[model samples]
Target: MTATATAAVIAPAPEAAPALRDTRPLRLITCGSVDDGKSTLIGRLLWDTKAVKEDQAAALNRDSGKQNDLGLPDFALLLDGLQAEREQGITIDVAYRYFATDKRSFIVADTPGHEQYTRNMATGASTADLAVLLVDARAGILEQTRRHATIATLMGIKQFVLAINKIDLINYDKARFDELSLEFKEIALSLGVKQVTAIPVSALKGENVVYDGKASMPWYEGPTLVEVLELATVRSAQTVGFRLPVQRVSRPGESFRGYQGTVAGGAVKPGDSVVILPSGMVANVKQIVTFDLVRNAAVAGDAITLVLDRQVDVARGDMIATIDAQPQVGLAFDAQLVALQPGGIEPGKRYWLKSGSRRQRVSVQPSSLLDLKSGKWNRHDGALPMNAIGKVHLSFDEAAIFDAYELNRTTGAFILIDPDTNNTVAGGMISAKRGDLGGLNNEAERVILSLPADLADKILASGILSERRDEIDIRRTNPGRAAELLGELDS
Candidate 1:
């Protein structure tokens, strides 16, 4: 019999609260290797929480065609809403679901587990507070599991739940659960994730998910999945100072000039001093406007129109930030990126880098590639293949604004768009400013390139030197200065 059929034979006990509940909606992503029961887990969470409406349940029943012995409709049917997913019995894209309990609410992202859809998983994870990484109890850990964990860490997720699912398949074996938990704890530590909860669950049976499974596994004494989610801490962006990347300048009227954008970090209020970046124009906040009542102040995640006290040359792509705490501004930076497209990220190739509301031209140079299996950085300076993570140096044509992703995720994250195809080729996080690599260096170590005037003009006009022209020094050779320089060199 299937796990769902077995669940019908078992009786559920009364539910009880484990601890004081947090009211904030916990945003989380469910991800793992393919066929790891991500869809079923989410469907069951929704079903047990009574989030599914009667009409929706009835539709699921009709679409599923057959019911398990427990009279439960195929739970996966509720989340695999796409026609292709329904036909293939797999989730292709990220499916978001909303459910609530007495203590808290949730916005769960049911992400595809397939390796090719890893980019979709990353997209979902970008906004999640916690990650539930599922694994079949019989299959220990796979490479895809490590990939998901690595990506989750790179995306700034600190809380993790290692769902050793299908525990029933192993006869509710406690030893196997302990072994997997120990192994995963090591992996979590390696990724700098200190908060990890491991649970043996039969998502197909609703065991240790919403309700306790003491009837079948009395030896286990951990909180259910719902309990852990209720108590998990939400990520906060208050530590980073205020940031507002201007999306557009509102000119509803000539007198009403307002800059509009979402607050990326910290808080802003009227009379606060702020600076416009790349241009470094300073202004004081006049008002915070919104569709509703004019807000006294705006915090991170608030979308508001900010009016400055003085007229300035502020435009889209410029950042309005606290003067004392500003984002890093430089021509070069270090970053880690996950190549998303099949074409991969080619070194020394120019791509469009978009962060916040600003997009600029940048050339990427690969520094090292991450080995998912060993969780080590291998020395590499080549094309970063799709799904590969690599450390790279980004050289920009203009001043690039960012923060270290470790400090503020909102200001630190960016995407690389291919100029030729206009497709997003990679997602990256700023590590640090490439400080002073171009600073005063030993002149004796510099290489000089000499060519005829026509050849040099051709090289400069070919766009190859367009990005590096500012770093190059050119001098016109003459009989007077040339001889004088040669004489000094001989001395």
Candidate 2:
């Protein structure tokens, strides 16, 4: 008997999976040599992301009387918002744009690419987590490319995207792309940057920018520019212990007193014990207060008003940190800086150093300058010229607080303002604490304070040693050693 064919059933197609999206915004900067199409690339990104409103697009069309052969309006017009920039067809300042996609959102800074505007580029790169370094395929790598990469690396940017723009000019040749990518990879490696993604694209034609260019070049199978950003990690200050630099002491009424500042480094809870720097005053965190709510905890990047269990002498320029993990307090520090202005950073010059919310007078002594082209530090004892990356020693007139830049950037980085001009001259990162004999010698003056451990703790808690904290060194010694040291001092 032939059994009737079993009724066939087909499973309904699974509903299309919802596209995964990253809501957190990625902050990035676009920088390169002059005429590398930085504005065009950013404009292309904004247009492709549909961030441009209809009215803005209409204005772009109106402003740009002529369109390219592809019928796309002058994309640079979208970014060069200044009339001077439009007239000169160049970006003079840092232009910021915000856009989003199904995968992620982005906040991009279109920075000026001129050599003289390196300061502007550095300003943009300061807050960027990733840098999209552009280069014209026809021009290959330029000196400004290296300069920008060096600046970005120095600013703690780890992820880099080398966009080989104007690929259409070279016929989108894979060989050309490979050569440039290999060269740039070596440069990135030299800068201690390992996360580098190189892509071939023509910003003018919108290839491999926000969209895939499979039709133009089928060989490229990797993700587009937007894809790299979606997966990149956001730079977080939570890697270290908590540090809050007091911007101001907020006292609205007799009933309330709060320390207002952004958490520079780790996290703090309501019951955590903290120390006020430069004063060594200890207090327990009573509340984490914000405008909208009284929070239980606060982490890095949180701007909150903190109330302590009792009123201690907390003031602006003072740092409140976890008691067990205090920042380095010293009178001298070694730093790496990029000289910004034409006057250059002169040796033995006193400049105002602003780090976090603290500003202090610092004597800068130039030690060495970095040669961007050769990637070598040249022995230089003279002035650090404009656009020069140099190593210097910073001697503070008073107690200074900082962390190693590698450990916590927010507390370690600073900007130098020229006292004469009152203009910013350099941006620097603290490398390490300098000893008595520069950074070479570890020997330092030791002030042996012979007191009971309990008494010493009380003195520290009393905040009497805060002003002289950096000058005084406390050593935990056995009774025998303490007696010996006391006898030696008496002798």
Top-scoring candidate (TM-score):
2
> Clashes per prediction?
0, 0
Each prediction's Cα lDDT score?
0.87, 0.87
Candidate 1 yields a Cα-based lDDT of 0.87
lDDT of 1 by residue, 1-491 (tens): 68887777563422235243466788999999999999999999999999999999889888877656666789998889889998889989999999999888899999999999889999999999999999999988999999999999999999999999999999999999999999989988988899999999999899999999999999999999999998888899876789999999999988999999999999999988787887766778999999887889999999999999999998899899886577777788889999999999999999999998999999999989989888889999999999999999999999988988978888899999999999999999998887555342233222233333454465567676576666653323224544554445346
Whole-model lDDT, candidate 2? 0.87
Give all TM-scores, in the order shown: 0.84, 0.87
Residue 359 displacement (Å), model 2: 1.0
Candidate 2, 1-491: lDDT as tens digits: 13333322222223222346666789999999999988999999999889999999999889877657777799999999888898899999999999998777889999999988899999999889999999999999999999999999989999999999999999989999999999999999988999999999889888999889999999999889988988998888776789999999998999999999999999999988777887777788999999899998998889999999997998899999986567877789999999989999999989999998999999999888888889888988899999999999899999999988878889989999999999999999988888777653264733435443554575678787788788675533245655565455446
Q: Against the correct fold, how does model 2 do in TM-score?
A: 0.87
